[model samples]
Target: MSNEDQYGGGVGSGYGEVGGTGQTRTRLPDAPSDPYGTPRRAPRASRGLVTVVGVVVLLIAAIAFANQSSDSPRTPADQTPPAATSTSATGTRPVDGKNGAIPKGFAHDEQGAQSAAANYAVALVSADILKPQMRRQIVRQVFVADKVSELEARLDQAYGKTFLDQAGLDANGNAAQGLTYISRTVPVGTKAAKNSESTTTVDVWCTGVFGTAGVGSTNPVSNDWFTMTLTLRWAENDWKVESFAQKDGPAPVHTDRTASTAEEIAKAATEFGGFTYAR
Candidate 1:
């Protein structure tokens, strides 16, 4: 069969047929002429068509402009929102459980990933990481089961004698008799670089204090800024750390604020305990 016949657009369909000279096609009346042989006025049909075309073109341009805008206010004509409301529907789900001091059971979505990253950033840099037993606990609680052993071993090696000494802590991760070793991390904000059903990568921006705080201390506590990027896997109905890396931050400019005394710093750190952060 012919291609046209097979596809059902056979001959005599008039798809490509052209009118011949003998066809009685209707024509618009010629424009009117003046007695003085002046140029005739364009046809009423032609003028009416130009006006219609202009209005249609204007309408199309207006619609295109409205659609191209990034910051337009939503209206009835706006595109429909996502079907799943996710975090918004939950309205900051309260974190009511903890594995020791670390918050657990995040929401399993973007908000949950961000909260996990922020909380884990605190655990990663807190004074507890300097202590062997506490470090192991933190690793097990905040990290994936497969990574717990590896992270514990790595942390043990990293927080050896020299490392502790630099931070004014002893082999047991304790400060000298008169000084207090203060290490604390405050998460400023969190952003999820990637979030899916099974995995999430989050960046937590933080400021922290590290070093000994006391009269005549060699390394008095000082503030530093950093960003921790954590990759989390959704395992056992919770977001657990698979891996984490940190880098010096997008820090704000420092003010020439008067420095507090080491004694005052130690007193404040002790008096004002940390918080359990939420989204």
Candidate 2:
């Protein structure tokens, strides 16, 4: 690794023929390195352009990431998200028990009000309403305490001996030998017109049979349609009627089906019991 060994090849590369004692060597200006021999790098301006484009791409990606991260947080323009569970689900206690044959306790909501209205409508027009004791029981059970006395008096006055006679019933409100009294109500649907925490107004659409059935019957049982509107108050963990009123004929056109025989009507009335709604 002598300096001469390292430098000799380089020095020899500059020499011409060395035979004559007076030989002269020419070192031409190292023929300017061929500009096209080795691979050329991109021009400075083009390299700068590539760098600028890469920087712009990075900024766009960074801005997109920021927007995606903020998506879950609501802005003023965003609507409120729905709750995972409903608030109405609470304070809901179904009428699992009954007060005698009728459901007594009800939920503290619109459904409860509708149910109470429907049941009350049925009781108000039932055959039992003709019996004073049963009528009293119904008034006490269905109406608010403040309204019970007034409603009972009105009902008693309405179902007097004269009305009973016209209805094909005796003084005791009973149909005579070989006849069956039919006064049954069926609620088709109920709607809550207004509802609040303590009070609700509801409409009960009902269909009923309200005449005597059986052979030699003076009053053949027939269908009647009516709507009963009841304003109810939430009381003693149940719904009770504060006021009630009834109107006739939002009835449908009469069905084309032939009327049933008196015997069949009487049999069906006795065999099929009324239903209590669950809300």
- Which candidate leads in lDDT? 1
Candidate 1 regions off by >4 Å? 1-91
Q: What does candidate 2's lDDT look like per residue over 184-208, in tens digits?
A: 6677777666679998877666666
Across 1-279, the per-residue lDDT of candidate 1 in tens digits comes to: 000100110000000110000000000001111000000011112223343223222222221211121222212222545345422333685377999999998987888888887787666556665567776787678877886665455445434564444444577778789888665667787766677999987766666565457776645455655455566889988988765444344668877888788789889879998887765
Q: Which ten residues in a row have the lowest lDDT in candidate 1?
A: 19-28
Using TM-score as the measure, the top candidate is: 1
My TM-score estimates for the predictions, one after another, are 0.67, 0.65
Name the lDDT of candidate 1. 0.48
Q: Give the TM-score of candidate 2.
A: 0.65
Error of 1 at 70 (Å): 40
